[model samples]
Target: MTDTRVAVIGGGVIGLSIAYHLAEAGVETTLLERGALGSGASRATADVVRSYFAGNPVSSALAVRSLEAYRAFPVRPGTDLPLRQVGYLVLFSAPEQVAAFEADLPAQRRAGVDVRLIGVEEARERNPLLGDLPLLAAAWSPQAYVSDTAAIVTAYAEAARRSGATLLTGRPVSRIDSAAGRVFTEDGGELTAEAVICAAGAWSPALVRGAGVDLPMTAPIEQELLVTDPLPPGTPEIPCTLHAASGLLSRTRGDRLLVGMGYPGPDREAWRREVAERFAETYPGLAELDLHPAVTGLRDASPDRRAFIGHLPGPPAFLYATGFSGHGLCNAPAAGELVRDLYLDQDPGIDMTAFAVGRQRTG
Candidate 1:
C-alpha cells in the first residue's frame, strides 16, 4: 500500500483547486484523474463569473467570497488566465420580469454585489448593440468578471505540482474501498491514503456509490455553448448579458463572442440545437452571423441546484466537492479554500451549511 496523506479523485477545476490548496497547506496530496486535467466540464464551461444570484443566499455569499479569492490569484496580472473585470448586464425582455429584477436587487445589494437596477433607456445606452429591443429594465454589477477557465485550471495544476502534490492521469478509479483506505484503479494499481475526496463532477454519484454511499445527485442537464466568428471591428465590447426571457447569456471573449443557454434534461445533442436556434432568435443581430458548431458538456447538478460539498456521511475521511451545477468555473477558488479548511480541521471562513451533502431534501 502506497501511503499518501490525501487522495483527490477527478482532475476537473474543483479537484485541481482543492489539491493545490492541500499541497500549499503542507499536506501530502495525490490527485487521480480519469482523463487529463480540465478536459471535462471545466474546459467546456462558458466562464460566466458573476454573483447576481436571486433568492439564494448561500450561493450569493459563496460567489462573493470566491470572487475575492479569484481576484487575488497572480494569474490575473502575469498569467494567461486574462481575468477581466467586465461587469454583467442582466436584461429583462419581458415587462413582468422588470419587477422580478427589481425585487432581486435589494438581496443582491445585501450580499455586497455592486448591482444597480436601471431603466430600459439606460440599458440601451449601456449597450448600443442591444438596439430597439424593448427591454423593460436591467441590473448591472461592475464587480462581475470572466476568467479563462482553461488557464485557471492549468495554473492550479501547476501550483499543486510545485507545492508537492502528485498528479496521476489516464487512471480511472474503478473501486473505492474507503474502509480499507485504498482506492483500486482500473489498471490494477491501488492508492492508499489517509483521506479521499470525490470531485468527479458529473460522474461523482457513481464514485460515491462504489465507496458504499448513496449521494443525492444526478447527471446534469447538459449546457450548450456557441462561439461566433469575430465580430466586426468597432462593435462595442458587450458586458456579459443575460436575457431572462430565454435563459441565454452572451459575453465577449477576445475577438469571438461566446454564447450559452441552459438545457432542461440529459439530452446533450438536443440541447445544443435548442441553444443554437434560441441564440439566433434572441439576438436578431446575430441572425446573419454563422454560428459555429455547438458543443455540449455535463454539469454536475443537485436536486436544489446548489453544490454538494463537505464530508461524506459514511466515512469520516471521505469528502465530497461535487455538484456545482454549471457555476463551478466562478466558484473554483472558493471551493479550494473550503476543501483546505475541511481537510485541516480549520474554520471554513464561509458558512456552507446549505451545500452540505446531508442537508434535508424536500424533493
Candidate 2:
C-alpha cells in the first residue's frame, strides 16, 4: 500500500514544483505522472519567462517571485536552469493598443515588473530587426529572460526526490476519490493520501470531474514555430518580441528564431501562414529565413486568464493549481510556493483572495 500526505496528479513543471515545495517543507508528498516528466504543456512551452502581465498584478507578482526562484535555483549535476537574459519587447502599433498597455503599466510596475514604456524610435534602436514596421510604443521588460522548461521540471523533480518526496513516472491516474483521498491508476494500482492536487494542466478538468468537482477549465491548442537561420553568425540576436497589435512572437535561441501565436481557427494551414506573414511583417530583416515545422501544446485556460489556485469547497483536501493560461512557465515557482503554504495552512504572504476558488473575476 502506497500512502502519502499529499498526492499531486501531474508531472509538468507546476506539479514537480509543488511536490518539491511541499516535500521540502516536510510534507509527505508523492507526485504521479502518466508519462515522463514535462511531457505535457511544460515540454511545449515557448521557453520565455517574463513578469509583465498587462492588467493582472497578482500574476505579475507571481512571475516576479518565480523569476527570483529561477535565479536562485539549486545547481547540481543534471539539474541546471539555463537562462538567456535577452529580455522582452512588446510592440504596440495602434493608439488604443498603446493606451491599454499604458493603463496597465502602473499595476505591473507595482507588482515588481521592471517594465517601462518606450517610444517607437527608441524601441527600433533596441531592435533593428523591426525594419520599417510602424510602432506607436513598446513595453520593455529588461529583466525578463528565457529558460528551458524541461530543465526546470527535471531540476524540481530531483529536488523533490532529494527532499524525500516520491516521484512516479508512467503512473497514469485514471480517477480520484477526492472525498476518500484515494487515487486509482489505469494499471490497477491504487494509492491514498491526505490531500490530492489536480495539477494535470489540460488533463485536469476530466480528473476533477470524476470527483464531482466541475472546474471551469478549457484546453486550447497553442503552437510555436521554429525558424532556423542558415548562417548562425549573421543572425542578429533579438529580445523576446511580441506585437501587441497581433498576438505574434519572435525570439532567438542560438541560430533559430521561435515564432508563435494563438490563432483560434479550424484551419491550421491558415494559422501557419498567419504566423509566417506576421513574423515577416514585424521583422522584415529575417523574413526569408528558414521556417521549420510548428510545435504545438495545450493550455488549461480559465475565464479570467488567471489561474485557479487554493482548495475546493469542503472535505477530502482537494487542492487545485491548474488553469494557468499561458503563464505556467513563468509562474510555476511562485505557484508551487503558494500551493505549499495553502496546504500547510499557513500564510502565503500574497493576496489569497485574488486566486481564491470562489472569488469574483474582476478581469
Candidate 3:
C-alpha cells in the first residue's frame, strides 16, 4: 500500500480545493478521482457564485470567504479565472419570504456583504427582463458573479500539483478502512494515510457509510435548461435571479438564458415541464425563446442544508467535506481552508459547530 499524510477522495471543485490548501500548507496529500478531474458536479454546475443565504449565517460567512479567494484567484491559484460580476437578484412574492430575508439582512450586512432589500421597481430596474409579476420585494447582492467553474477547478489542480500534491484520476475508491487510515480503490490499489477525507460530492453518503458512519446526506438530481433569448437587443441582460416562492432559478449566458427549478420528487419529465411552464410564465416577454431539454446532475445536501466539514464521530482520521447542496462552487475555497485547518488541528477562525457532523438539524 502506498502511504501519504492524507488521502482525499473525489476530484471535483471541493476535492481539488482541499488538496490545494493542504499541499500549500506543506502536507503530503494525494487525491483520488473516479473519473477525470472536474468530470462530476463541478462540470455540471450552473457556475453562478453568490453569497446570499436567507437564514444561514455559517454558509454566508463561508461564501464570503470563498468569494474573496475567487476574487484573488491570480494570487492564490496563480491562474486567472473568468469571472463576470453580473450580480444576483432574488425576487420574493410572498410577505413571509420578504420577512425572512429582512430578518437576516443585519447579519449579511455585518459580514461586509452589500446586500439590499429593494422594492419591486428597483428590482425590475436591476433586471429589465423581469416580467410584470407580483414581486413584493427583492434581495439584490451586487457582488455576486458568474464564474468559469472548469477553469477554477483546473487552476486548483495545477496549484495543488505545484505544491507537491499527487492527484490520481480514474481511481474509484471502493472502501475506506478509516480506523486504519487506509483507502481501498476499486482497481485493487491500496493507500494508507494519517487521515482520509471524503469529498466525493453526491457519492459521499455511500462512501462514508462503508466506513460505518451514517452521514445524513441526500443526492438529488437538479436540472437546468438552456434557452435562446428572444428579447430585443436593447433589452438589459438578466442577472442570476431566483423566484423564492416557486424555486425557479434563471440566469443569462451571453444571448441565451439558463433556467431551472429545484424539484422535491423523482419525476424528471414532470420537473422539466414544470420548470418550462414556470419560465414561460415568469418571462412572458420571451415567448418566442426556444426551450431546450434540461441537463440534469446530482447535488448532495444535508438535512439542515449545510455542509458537514469536520471529522467523523468515532474515527477522527476520517473527515467529511461534502453536502454543499447547490452551492459547492461558490463555497469551495473556504471549504478547502476549513478542511485543511481541521486536519492540521488549527482554528479555522469561524464558528464551525453549525457544520459539525451529526449536528441537530433545525432548518
Candidate 4:
C-alpha cells in the first residue's frame, strides 16, 4: 500500500506542477517519474509562450492565464523561469493567408491578446531580416514570450519537495491497482494512495490502460527542433516568429537560432533529415547553419487536438490529465491549478466541458 494520500504518475512539468500545487494545498502527494524529472517532452520544449490560438476561447484563456502566472512567478534565486517577453511574429506568405490572419486579429484582440497586423513594409521596418521576400502580412504580439521549461519544472519540483511532497525518479510504475489504491512499480514495491493522477505524457495511455481504463489518447507525432550556429552579425534580436505558410517557428536563443517544424505522424528519422535539408533550402540565411544534432520527442495527441483532462469513467479514485498534444508546456501552470481544484472538489477555474474525456467523438 502507498504511504501518501495522492500518487501522481509522471514527474514531467505537468505532474510536477500538479504535485507542487497539491502538496501546497496540504495534500500528501508522491510523484513518480520513469526517468529523471523534466527528462521527457518538457526538457525538449522550445519554450514558446503565446496566446494566438485559432480563436479557441478555452485555450486562449488558459494561455493568457499561464502567461500571467509565469510573469508573476518569482525566479528561484538563480533560475530563469520568469517570462522573457521577446514577442512572437507570425508571418503569412500568401494573400489569402494574410486575409485569414487579419480576420483572426479581431477575435485575438477580443480575447485580450496584444496582437497587431502588420504589412510587409512595417514587418521589415520592425525586423529588417525579412530580406525583400513576398510576404503578405504578419501578426505581432508583444505579450508573447519564452522561458526555460526545464528550469521551471525544476523549480516546481523543488517547491513541491519543500511543501512535503515525495518525488521518486527512475521508478516506473508497472501497474496500478485502482480499487486497492495502490501502485506497483517495476522495482517490486507498491505504494498506496487515496487518489491517483495519471499525468504521464506520451506514455499516459499505457498507464491508464494498465488500470483497465481505455483512455482516448495516442502518441502519434514526434516534433523535431534545429538550432543554428550563432546568428550572423546585423541580424536583429527578432521575436519568436512563425511562418504560417511553411508551418515553421523560429526564435532567437542567445546567439543561436532555434527553429522548429511540425510534421504529421511518427517519422522521427525522416523528419530529422528533412528538417536539416529544409532549413538549409528555405531560409537561405541559414544555408550554412550548423544543424545541431536533431532530437525527437513524442506528443500525446488526441483525435481532437485538445487535452483529455478530468476524472476517468471507471474507478472513482483514478483521474487523468493527458493528451495535451504539443501544447502542454504552455499550459502546464493553468493545468496544475485545474488539477488541484479537481482534487479539492472545487471549480476547475475554466469551463472544461469541451475538454472532458467523457465527450463523444464526432468522427
Candidate 5:
C-alpha cells in the first residue's frame, strides 16, 4: 500500500482531473485554487472537442482518448458536462492545407480518430450556411461537438471530491519549494506533499520559474467565439467549424452562434471589426450579423507547439502539464490521465518522447 500525499497546485480542469485520478488510485491528494475552479481558461473555452490533428499524432491520440472519456463522464456520478456529438467540420480554402490534411489522414486514423475528407456539397448539406463559398474541400468528423466547459470543470472537481480529495479555493500559491516538496501559499501557509503537479495554465510560468525552471510558454489573448445575440427562427445547425487557412473556429450555442479566431495580435476591437467585415462574405446567408459581448480568454502557446507532462529533471516532486498551445480542452482527458500516471509513477502506455522534448524542459 502507498501513503503518498500529493498536493496539486492550480485547481483548473487539468489539476482537478489529476486529483480525481490520484484519489481513485487511493493516493491522498489536495488541490489548491486561487479562485473558484476553472475560473481561468477553462471557463473561457470555446468547447469544441475533436481529434483532427493536422500533423501532430501525440495531440491527436490524446484527443481521441479524451473524447471517449468525455462521453463517459456525465454518467460517472457527478457531472453536467452536456457533451454533444453534433459535428466538427474543417474547411480548407487553400490546396496546401488540403494536401497537408490528406497526408495527416493516415496518422489521424492510426491515432484512432475516424475522420474523412468530403466535398463541400456534403459539408453544406450538414451546415447549410456554407453554400457556394471559396471552398476547396472539408474534413468532416461527425462525432465532434461542443460541451459546457464550466460544467466539465465542476464535474471534475466534484468527482475529485467524491474520490476523497480535498479542494480549497481563493488561495493563491506564492512559491514552490521543490527540494523540500512543499508549496507556500500567498497567505503564508505551507502545504507539503510527496509530489506536486503544476496545472496552473498561463500562470504556470510563475510557479515553475521560482523553482529554477524556464518555460518557453507565453500567455496570449485568445479572441474566441464572440456570440451573436440570437439567430432568427429556423436557423440551420451551426456545425463546429475550423477554417484551416484563416485560423477561425466557431460553434453554436442554442439560438446564438459563438465565433472566434486565433489571432494573437493587438486590440480585440480590430479583430472584431475584421471578423464583422468578412462575416457576410464567409456566410452570405446571414444578411445581418449582430455580435454580442465577447467571451474573451487566454491561451498558453508553446514554441514547439506541444505540451509538457513530465517531472523536472532536478526534482521528482516538481511535475508540469502545460504548453498545450491553445488546444487544452481537446487534450484534457488524456493529458489528465497521463499526468495521473506520472504522479503515481505508473506507465502511461504511450510514446511521450516528443511531448516530453518541448521547449520548457527544466528543473
Candidate 6:
C-alpha cells in the first residue's frame, strides 16, 4: 500500500500508538510532535488502569481491551511495559453513592470487570491508612493495574521504530490540506499522506478546525495528582482508592502516596483542606502528609468523558482519535488498533457508532 501513507499529528501516546499500528500494518506512517514524545497528557495521566465504567458500557469495554493489551504487551515481541497489577477500589461514602454505584454495576459487570462490593472492614484491612472512616461500601477491582505511562509510550515508540515508522519530534504541524491529503508544518515542510489522524490532545481543536472540521472539546487544567514524600513504616502501600463522590483518589507511586482530585490551583487551599480532612477521617497517617504536585496538566474533556474514535467525514478523510479526557494513556493501544482498522476499512471488533463525531459537531 505505497499510496497509503499516514501522517499522525501529535506524538503523544495516542498519536504514537496510531503510527505504530499503522506502520506495523504496512502503511507508511510519520508522527509529528512539537516537543518530546509522551511529554503531554499521556504522561500527565493518573496511571490507575481499570475497566469499571460508571455507566458507559462501550467505554468500559474499550478500557478492558486496553488493560488486557497492556497486561499481554510484555510477552509480545518488542515491548517492555512497567505495569503493576495493584488493585483499584471505588468507595461509597454515602447511601446515595451506593445507589449511584449500583446503577453502574450492571454495565461494569457487562464489561467483564472482576469486582464485588465489600464492607468497610474489608476496605480497612486492605488499606492500613483506612481508619474507621464510616465508608458504607467499596467495589473492589482485583485485576486493576498501574504503570509508568512514559515507559509504555516508549515501548510503543520503540515498536513503531522497529516496524519502520518515521518519528519526528520538535516538528509541529501548522496546517493540513485535507482535500489534498497533505500536512504542512510552520517551517513550510509538507508531506502528503492517504490518511491524516488528529491526535493532538489539548491542541487538537485548532488543528481539526484548520482541517475543515470542528471537534467540540475542552482542555481543562486538571490537578490530577497531589503526591507526598515516602510513606513511613506504618503506612503501607494500598490499592488505588477513588472516593467517587468527593473526587479524591489515592494510590502509591513508588514510595509516595498520591492524592488527586480535579480542583484547580486557585482553590489549592480549599482542595488541600478538604483532602486533609478526608484523610484524617479515613487514612490517618496521610492526613498531614504535605502534597507535592506531579504531572498535572490539561485534561482533554469532551461532552461525555468517552473518547471520539471514528473517522471525520471528508473528501480529505481525516480520523479523529482525541478527546479521551483522563483515560488517554490507559486506552492508547486499543485506540491505535481502532485507528488501524478504520484506515484499512476493516471492522473494529467494537461498535464505534457512539464515538462518531456527530453531524451537529461536524462542519
Off by over 4 Å in 1: 75-80, 264-277, 312-316, 358-363
Pick by lDDT: 4 or 5, better one: 5
Q: Which one wins by lDDT: 3 or 6?
A: 3
Compared with the true structure, the alpha-carbon lDDT of candidate 6 equals: 0.78
Regarding TM-score, does 1 or 6 come out ahead? 6
lDDT tens per residue, model 2, 1-363: 438889999999899999999998999999999999988778777788888877777889999999988888854223557888988888988998888887888888888999988999888877777878777789888877888887788788888999999999999999998888899999999998888998999888889876677767765655445555553466678898888878887787766877777644588777777777877887776778767764666667877778888775435588989888888999999999999988888889988778865565453
Task: Give the per-residue lDDT digits (tens) of candidate 5, residues 1-363.
Answer: 112378888777778888888887787888999988887777677777877667777788888898889888757634656767778888888899889888888888898987899998887787777646789889988768678777778788888888899998988999988777788888998887777788888788888876677777766546465777678899877788877767666677888888776663777678777776556566767648777655656667677667877776434377888878767888887887887887666789897666763434441
Compute the lDDT of residue 83 as modeled in candidate 6.
72
Global CA lDDT of candidate 5, please?
0.77
Rate residue 11 of model 1 by lDDT: 95
Misplaced by over 4 Å in model 4 are 75-82, 99-110, 210-212, 263-273, 276-282, 312-316, 358-363
TM-score of each predicted structure versus truth: 0.90, 0.93, 0.94, 0.89, 0.92, 0.92
On TM-score, who's better, 3 or 6? 3
Candidate maximizing lDDT: 3
Q: For candidate 4, report its TM-score.
A: 0.89
Clashes of each: 0, 0, 0, 3, 2, 0
Q: Go through the candidates in order and give the C-alpha RMSD of each one to the true structure.
A: 2.7, 2.2, 2.1, 2.8, 2.9, 2.7
Q: TM-score of the candidate numbered 5? A: 0.92
Error at 214, model 2, angstroms: 2.5
- Residue pairs with colliding backbones in model 2 are none
lDDT of 4 by residue, 51-157 (tens): 76654545666777777777767742123465777877877788887777777667677666787788778776665555546687887778778788777888888
Go through the candidates in order and give each one's C-alpha lDDT: 0.78, 0.82, 0.83, 0.76, 0.77, 0.78
Candidate 2 C-alpha error for residue 279, in Å:
1.4
